[model samples]
Target: MRKSSIYSVLFGTVIFTTITAALVSVSSNVAIAQILPISDRNKSENSISQVNVLFVNPSIGNDTKANGSESAPLKTITQALRVAKANTEIRLAKGTYSAEMGEEFPLIIKQGVSIQGDPGSQGKDIIIQGGGEYLSRYYGSKNIAIVGTGNAKLAGLTITNPTPRGYGLWIESDRPVVENNTFTGSTQDGVAVMGNAAPQIRNNNFYGNGANGITISGTSQAQIEQNTFQNTGFGINIAQNASPQIIANKISGNRTGIVVQASSSPVLRNNSIFSNKEDGLVVIAKAIPDLGNSSSPGGNQFSSNGRYDINAASATQQVSAYGNNLASNRIAGKVDLTATAAPVKPLSLLTRRTPTLLNSRLQRETVTPQPTVPNTDSQELNYVQIQPGTIEFTAPGAASQSSSLPALQPASTGNSALLPVPPDQIPASKTGSPYMLPPGLSQNPATIQPTPQTPPQITATTTQTGSRYRVIVEAVTPKQQELVKFIVSDAFQTNRAGKQVMQAGIFSDRNKAKNLVRQFKNNGLKAEVIME
Candidate 1:
């Protein structure tokens, strides 16, 4: 590694029995602040590799005549970026600096320049504020606060409150390191990755942003790890052929946790997704998110969402041969495979922990069978196995008893067992499958005899069934009408006179309706299904 101006010293001491003579030795600590040349701005006429340090202190800096040294620093980061050369280090002090103060918006850093904040403080003191409520270069709203082209690094700074259309950081560059930063209140997104920019975004906190916390688009690839996305619209939005490694993130309290759309294939591993208003993960239109791979363990926990934990919208888009490994994910709602076939059981519920970076050569982890699907009453399933041409249920004793029951009519060619037969529809004679019945269904087979006629089959391909009614979960007054817009964003709604009412969902399938009510109730909403 290349060594910079920063220095450190390590010491070791040992005590022996010779110290028994009431020996009380003293310990001393020492620190030295080294000063270096501000920059080699004039060195274009010559070569001065030794002068690589540039300092910026908003309070003490002089934009007109400062030499960019520890004693004579530049006034603004924009000044340093303009004068500094490649491999130059710009050291920032504690203060709030804005682009409106003679500095430019969308401050572009030169190639190979690393912008670093105070070493003693972890960015708590450095603040970079920018203008614009919405970001659009054409409209002059200044869409991005910081823009980097190549070999740029930013650390230990809080970038907040750019124009609503602006983002904290916008990278069109390649190989940037953005760490130890907090991004908040951006109207569009916290970070927008465009082009082939592959940045390392780690240990960052993104909160209360107007749009998706981070958006990766246009063939951009990034490693997003150990970040916190709270109270945002979407945690991470991957689109337009962008593929990112999203790992170890705590994504909570957002409208939707992660949305994979438009042919983006992102690797989502070891993320904790919970408390979103909508689904934890929504895969739409050919977007394939790799939850698990042979080389790495994929166990993301998803729970407490308003709808299904994972909604694989189209079956034709296959993420993997066995689908993404959801083995250890703590899912509250069932997986809604409306158009897709469910993944196989064996690969879905493997129990191995993810391998550490140092132990890449360890043998493939053992696959642990998922806990059998519990009784379908109040207990939600831990796993749903969707296999090609068959749907397998891991109910404790349901497998042996399935042979005696009437075979469920499989759906279309690729979708078998996609739709489960309701317990109430089963004939009075033959006992129903354990996986089909909710809590109070008949379990004793001796009481009823099998009907001579074949029972009606429920195919998965059918979109609607049973009743076409929705429960009005809540009624809002005229004064609280604004809240209806927020609730309607997640739930269906209708207006009557001056009042607004929220509908859990309009469902022809009773089971789906019940699941919706349960999902709404889980989010502390009073919801029930009404049969019409």
Candidate 2:
């Protein structure tokens, strides 16, 4: 509850509105910016708690006869929304609430009425798919899942709207708290803040949407922080007079990260923009983004994007980029690099208990090392590059995001234990990815050289299916490619680090895959099976 000149909320944390003071932040740097320091970074409880609680379970509860209680909960979220009043809390159970499940589209959440799902899982198990037409005053009829009309909150829900020109959540007017949610597979943006709305959007996972992760327009000023936007078209799209504060979000793996156009001005600070196929931050038209200045350091990090990290599309527009970390030499447009931003160390390099000061949360700038293999002289090479150990960012309030390398523990047999990478690290095969690596990093396993056809021989799949698994056999030598012909589906997958690998088949029975594992083991090859 510490007070300061600047009001602030940490990434992925449960945010309750204080809305005391907010104004232009881009004109200055993060160092001089007055951001409220939260004495408790992980504190979820705050003043202005919900007045009433209503429960809805799509599995067992009855929609028509139920009283929206815990035991006798409503069946569908639409039913709960019909009876929920202002200041009421609607709790959803773990299940799909879609058209097939009887959920009505474009569920309108009234002011002060909060809708919450499982924040811990980022609502992965709590799916709310399908969208309905929402008539917006700014735009015409639009298809969206939920519309937050002023001071309502949508948290801990996995929302998707697959219709053409659809969005997961749309906010119009007033302020809303949209946190700890997963917005994916939408035909349009995961969330759109329009019509002078200033919503607090933090700790959400936005991916695989047709358009940008979050599109801000019509003078909307949103506090977008601590969100990880990957594999989307554009991470954050700002257009036409909208001015939002974009802070501390990791925007990567998209065609482009942040695009500001049509006279919109956004304050960008402490964000990690890296390894995108194109520019990280594209500023077009008359839009002016406060990247950084001499007086206040931006503290933003950029690296390894295929094109320029920050592309000021207009040659006439000299982006006032001062005191910000610039890792790449590729530059487009006129940018004022008057001052050098301090080099931020990776999170793995620091050791601390909890961050009380706002500056301590400064993100790591991406650094890409040369992609080369280990020579024969080197006895062992830990293929994983320098990745920060366990750093947590919130979409589920406490999820750590970093590329994990294979551990080279001293084994008696001198074989490295190949572990499966995090599911999110791997880019989905649905899109065209040049190489969605973590700052251009890939390491070779111990004693195992990579083949030309399949970069690394030691392969592991992250997906898990019940009662069956995919056996990963190491093809250390090129001649070993034909050792197993059990490749079932052309489920060709690229590893999280953008390394292409030959994946084994997913047998219907675990026993069949076990036989393959045993067969590979008998052939003096190290093999392991993981889920799916």
Candidate 3:
């Protein structure tokens, strides 16, 4: 029995040792399966190249062959633009650089790269001037743009004197932020943005240009805030199916200020629009401006205008006016009225076929009724023949005379007071006493006398200051109406309104108008002087 027990214990111990060994082998295999392959781990650890190019003063005239460093840098924005790839930084030093004329030297930034200007002690004093004529085709051909796919930031720089035909900065790329810049003296628009390029344009001053200050088109989104548009043809023109939020902008001294035309839906809030030529704020036929208390505060103010203050055909579309100040206009505060109502609903199976039927119904309900002609039997007879010896016939038929005429009296009573006649009454014939004018003169007649003309009295007096100049008068030709238009347009550019001033008249005496023209010129004006 003892020998059997020892043998059983030895057997049990052997079984336990065999199980333990198998479990240890399974655990080792599971640990190995949890780890990634060596080849895959090696691939994940690979690094991408990140480079930074510096543009120093010495390298401004160098080529890309030199190392892009502070001591030796590549000259010309064109070379740096070419070698810049994704995840690259091209730093521009503070200096004045002249872009070559007719050259397509656009700095095209690739996706995932940032070409930031050096925010050194100089700040954004880098000035890029285009060397070309205003009308030259090559004017704006040499500007910088982030055309490649990705996000870009243009910070701290002054971009001026672009080619006349070109814009100061043309942004067609997507999601760019143009901050803290001065755009001035371009032949065309100062800053033109097209494509679906939605950019954040803020804290900019656009002044003194041949065309609009900031022209934005295309189906782009913009947050245009705290910008000043002064002394241009049109301050800020939003057209071409573009919708943007224009808030807190000082738009003045332009020909036509804030022209919201086309199919644009701009949320104009708290903007001070004043001193324009035709109207301070003009909304054409198709503009659907979302203007109301829900928009912005201190609504648009139209004051001291040459014509209608705020002009729109009617508020038919998506335009709503609330808490706006409309004051001081020659004509009506607003012009052109057309009844506009909500769209109609289809009542029948063919309702869609007659889309305008609902609009017609609303119009009919609001229109005034027209007068109808009376029937012949119901018409009041104006004349009735009396007997030859009748008292009524001897005097005159009451029906044939005016409503003020009195009934005829008996012949025995010769009181002239009974037949009262008006002081200015005219008899039927000249041979009769107090003869009335002939029928030719009474009804649709000829020989109309000329009424005395009343000259306009100038009540309000305005004083303009400028240096006095005298030039020899060659000819005193009558001032053309177009000349007045040009002068008014020039005045609009100089003032804060940025609107065209309609010329009241062109006086032959240059001395009388000299003060006004001088004031305009001193304020950066454009006017013409013609001798009388």
Ranked by TM-score, the better of candidates 1 and 3 is: 1
Worst 10 residues of 2 by lDDT: 389-398
Give the Cα error of residue 11 in candidate 2, in Å.
54
Better of 2 and 3 by lDDT: 2
Ranking of predictions according to TM-score: 2, 1, 3
User: Model 1, residue 311: what's the lDDT?
Assistant: 54
Off by over 4 Å in 2: 1-51, 339-532
Residue-wise lDDT of candidate 3 within 47-79, one digit each (tens)? 111234435342244663444445456565555
TM-score for each prediction?
A: 0.54, 0.56, 0.47
Q: Rate the local accuracy (lDDT) of all candidates.
A: 0.52, 0.57, 0.41
How good is model 1 by TM-score? 0.54
Tens-place lDDT per residue, model 2, 295-327, is: 446778999886678876442245777767885
For TM-score, candidate 2 versus 3, the one ahead is: 2
How many residue pairs collide in each prediction? 12, 5, 19
Per-residue error for 420 in candidate 1, Å, reads 38
- What's the ranking of the predictions by lDDT, best on top? 2, 1, 3
Off by over 4 Å in 3: 1-50, 56-61, 100-104, 112-124, 131-150, 275-278, 294-309, 313-318, 324-532
